[model samples]
Target: MSHWKHVYEKWRSFEQLDPALKQELDKMADNEKELEDAFYTDLSFGTGGMRGELGPGTNRMNIYTVRKAVNGLADYLVAHVGDARDRGVAVAYDSRFKSQEFAIETAKVLGAYGIKAYVFDTLHPTPLLSFAVRYLKTAAGIMITASHNPPEYNGFKVYNDDGGQIVPDEAHQIIGCIQEVEDELTIPHLQKDELEAQDILNWIGKEIDRAYLDKLAEISKLATGEQQQDKDLQIVFTPLHGTAHDLVLRGLSQLNFHHVDVVEEQAAADPEFSTVKSPNPEEHQAFTMAIELGSQTNADVLIGTDPDADRLGVAAKDSSGHYTVLTGNQLGALMLDYILTHSVSNLPTKARMIKTIVTSELGRKIAADYGVETIDTLTGFKYIGEKIREFESTGETFMFGYEESYGYLIGDFTRDKDAVQAAVLACEMAYYWKRQGKTLFDALHSLYETYGYYLEDMSSLTLKGKEGAEKIAAIMETIRKEPLTEVGGLDVEYVEDYLAGERTVIGTKLKESIELPKENVVKYILGNDSWICLRPSGTEPKIKYYFGVCGSSAQEGQQRLADLKRDMEDVISRVHNV
Candidate 1:
């Protein structure tokens, strides 16, 4: 039998299921393609957690999968900790498809295991879940969200007691427990009201929100009277129909900014995200409404958060007075310079900035000028969160951290990337720049001057279906077997094979050791200050190639990047035959 057939039969054998889930699965049975896509493989519970389409299949995200993941977590908790039932877990969900239902399912699974569970009463952002984990002092946390993925997708992210995602060692333990649960149908759960009667389930709301906001308020430092006097700078914000609408606005309003406007049409909690093709704010098209409103109101800046409020995107009026969207790298560099210049003067000399290896290096230059250190982690923001935990354990201050995918975190209040905090900081920086009779564009130009111009771009090649997955694997295997010595008219100066934990320089006999966790990623550094990185998507059938180039001027940077991109594309196409 085919894999889909086996998976479908397993689910069909369940003696009882909620009527709604039964109906949904029955509806999918009529479409062979949909059934196959839904059941081709079980939704993976990997290093981060489980993510998949929300529907009725072994592979889809539903109550059953949620229960499975949570049950595994409960088992892990029982084995690793003493008095696990008293320690409890924190649960929060965003405004995505069936997010609330999944969160409830997770709670019931925990409750059935005689474990305590504290869940948010309503939809909350991902960062808040991270905050609640540390604030409530829970043993673990679960966030039911897909972050910035499309409306058709949903997910669950697991965090440890430190409010960061599970690292490789912990993830392996959880996966082992998940594998031990052979019968999903036999998994236990509790009724919502019954769990409430037991007093093991608690619903948390406003108090936590207030605490989170108060911490966000202290992210930027101002003089005694700055908040009251700097109130006229205009800005527009949109949540992209996610969970951060009110929270972000409240945070900004608390800063005493009077000229802020919310994109009312995009403020509603719509799981379908009808206002945009994709809720991801990283793309300029996601800000169409915000830009229109900004142009009309002459708003100094525009900000947006994706569905889960973990990622942020910004648009600023450039030298031409036209709205230009800032890439995640650009925003991180700007925010780093702004926060360090404003906040670090009062702090100790050992302050540090954290960024992913894939992030642009401009922030590093700025931090160096300020006499601060920058640390590079792997691709995921979870590693940055882990670093924050390390800092807390060792009494080192974590000033700021960001990734190149529109994710930023400040003040360590949240273990994940926080669009809510970034929105506040963006507005504050815009106000400061406005007071200087300059725009963020001007600020960026000054940054380019202080640090040389840096240009970076990434391209994703998405493959779907089982065949596509096989092809992607083949490509990676080929790259590992016959490494390229050159790309885009430049000699490969160094090749970093993360899979092997080795960095080798061409024509050199020495190989340096890397301390980071092993991942299947490869980086090729070229001689012209240009580099290309290749990695397979952890959750999807796709491979992403990132290219970076730096030059003496912005025009020179653009030209070099264009030429490099064209050459790389040619090389990749000829090699892959796609």
Candidate 2:
């Protein structure tokens, strides 16, 4: 009599179910727990779209689920855009399992709804998908990728016409449309031949790629006249078996950087990402192959991009000849410093930079030093993209935007964080430092000395499945009920509860409204420029704790950051017990 059981029965009785899916259902007939887990509820689609393990159930990602999602998007488009077919939707997929299939399925669904679909001929990076939305002037866009998740996981991301992820309001509307569908198994989709004959599906490739790379080339600082001096700077680059291998190589080569070496083992388009435990560039283990290549080539710097090539990670050889992975915050600071310092003449008079609430304060300081204003948005690169759009309307220039999770954007040509541009900028930074007889590590030290020592660290705890989801909600509720007054032995100056849309001053308890859109996040400001933020991951089932502190010396900053992390962990443990 359970809802999931009833849904499972309906699916089992469906005559048109795919044979493979039917086989899976038969295999799970005797397994009650497995059935419950797979059919408990539909995979929740929000601003980030749906992500889950590949399987044959409502909670898993399959052809049925993909069709249902696209059906909802198609309906939403028809409702919003007057001529949906004319506006169309652009589609791109990465090198993930079933990515191409999902992309095609999405196109078929849209075509059945009389909406045109512009799809890439092959796998492309997420940023390029964003660019294609603007280039082709589509009503929306969809990207099929899990974006650095493990091989077992895949996802879909939806974007608005502005080339950014759908904002909260639009996401709610699309969710309503998705809920209206009574059965995922019965969602309509046109045959490929039918769509092609009707001209409802268009294939896009070389022209868009050329336009995007040309725009990226314009953002390069080293492409001007200093390429000759930087041509000898050794650089090791790896795409982590994603979509950046060819484009990044082509971009770097066009910039006249001849000493770049690619990690051959990881150059191929690999969905399994067999070389790394996880395709995430944020993890140190993901750089193993690139580090090995860096050592062999005596490269000055190493750069790696995630599976979708939107997030970038960098490692620089330190003084001791050991490769050290730079944190996302560190890399952002370095890129901001290099870009702002070198491009001062060309920067707009009212230029500004943006960072996420969970990102480090060091970027704000770096922006301040360069006389640029810094704005903070909720976590997620989409919010950054939204800010870029806002700036465009206001005639304000967007200098740079980044988050602590290795996502960076230099030019607004693409709304999302672009690893292609980041990789090239990082290489150029390394070469510039080389001309000064220094490594990026040395440059970072100099930055710390100039801007005071700032340290940041993030910790995430993954809680999976339905029970884990309930536990996560309970944890957030508990924290909201009993807000921390102080952390790490520092007095809490103020508390910003984004979910409640209020900032409460600790001593006076005077609350003010927060201007940003509502999200389930809480941040506690402490004395001595230390702070902590707690928020659930948007794309993953994990609660992340971001800790930051500023100190007069590197040793002091490291110790303070350690203390903050310990305190934050204790707080999480206490809340978990509740």
Candidate 3:
């Protein structure tokens, strides 16, 4: 009779459903709250594809939902491509629960449609999946991972032939195709053996790995002699029990980085991520193991990668002899300076850098000093990939791309953020500074001195479930309807409403259209060279606030950021009450 009840009834009527799934459904039969939460709506496939907790329901990540998503992709490839079977699709997974199973199931679904599926034989990082798409010349790609999410979560990320996540238009078409599939339970999948026998299924391994590693090696800016000399720099790395263990170690080894040590406890492929509360490298707690190892080895730098190994985090010893974690903005700025300064001779005539709008402006300033152009995209790395595609057409070379969330790309070989590449470059940067008797912290200080003190902070308020969804919508609507003219005693000189696709100058009341795609985000520019932006995270049930400020000194910058954060929270509290 109701939405949940209808879904429950439909799933109950499926005769061939897996017994485990049926058991899960039975457990929810009497729990109305849980049932509604699990079936009230389909798990959305956004621009990055569907991600949710693993369970049995339309609103969860399960075999049925995976089949449905893959079926939709299969149909789209068949309809849109000239030779879908020949182009095929590349599939990879990480070390999460059932990730390998999900990858196999996806291959099976595509195989049933007479579409070839190139799947990795073992758990691989997300960037390799992106590289596989281009190396194999696949029509599309799928990565079964949730990036840095907890062990309870898993997801499917779909990429186009260009190796970037599907943009809005293609995502819409795929969603349309998914909706057309009336019964997810009945989606056809061929047997793995049969698919292999018919040449519709293939397992990719060493060859792809070798090619990817070769391309990654090219990302190193240090000369062979320089890398050999820098090999004395002590380094510690941890994969956070995810997928980067092998490739990162091997990449560093290939570059002659001999004094590297891995946090042995966190080096294994652990689905539960037993070593940390969360697998996200962006969080300080995730670096606990690596930091300890760094101290023992007297390492110059420490690095950690999340579960899917697409994002990287770094910790370096300050002048006080204590390790301090660098925020994503800080790390991005350091990496940009390192790359541009070391590779000036090898850079193209028109080199460019790309960053998400939420990223700090300090990177732009550094790029300007190097005479390289900087471009801003929306929040997702997919948009950055799109810009790379545009650069290819215009004969502009992409030097680097990164997001505030710790994702980064150094070279064009991979269409996703690559911690492996970042780790290598980060090690080199640390070594370069260490050789000069300066720490990475010193490099950051020098940047501050040259570019003025820039401080940035981010906070997310997560609201879950149906009621929470409504509250999030209301918060965004209220902010859009009544914009803030001032925050923390700073005058708002301009307001950029991304949803409305316009930027308005408060003083002159002049408005200009924003050139980027429309998204539900609002940014306010302060007269003091500070800014604030509010946007709902596309992949999560949370509203994120980003604050940035520039001051005369580090202390001034930190204080201003604190004031802005407090004032912003007060503003949000009032808006929520309304």
- Each candidate structure's TM-score, on Cα atoms with residue i matched to residue i, is 0.97, 0.98, 0.98
User: What are the clashing pairs of model 3?
Assistant: none
Off by over 4 Å in 3: 228-230
lDDT of 3 by residue, 429-548 (tens): 898898899999999999999998998999888888887788899999999888888888899998999999999999786999999998999999996789999998877789999999
Q: Among all windows of ten consecutive residues in candidate 3, which has the lowest summed lDDT?
A: 223-232
lDDT to native, each model:
0.87, 0.91, 0.91
**How many clashing pairs per prediction, in order?**
0, 0, 0
lDDT digits (tens) for residues 1-578 of candidate 2:
99999999999999999998899989999999999999999998977699998888999999999998988888899999987789899999999999999999999999898999999998999999999999999999999999998898899999999999998999999999999998899888899999999999999969999999889888877646675443877888889989998888888887887788889989898988988898888999999998998999899999999989999999998989899999999999999999999878777888899999989899999899888999999999999999999886798899999999999999899999999999999988888898899999999989999988999999988999898888888988888889888788888899999999999999895999999999999999999999999888887889888999999999999988888888889889888877
Cα displacement (angstroms), candidate 3, residue 430, comes to 0.7
lDDT of 2 at 186: 87
Better-scoring candidate (TM-score), 1 or 3: 3
On TM-score, the stronger of 1 and 2 is 2
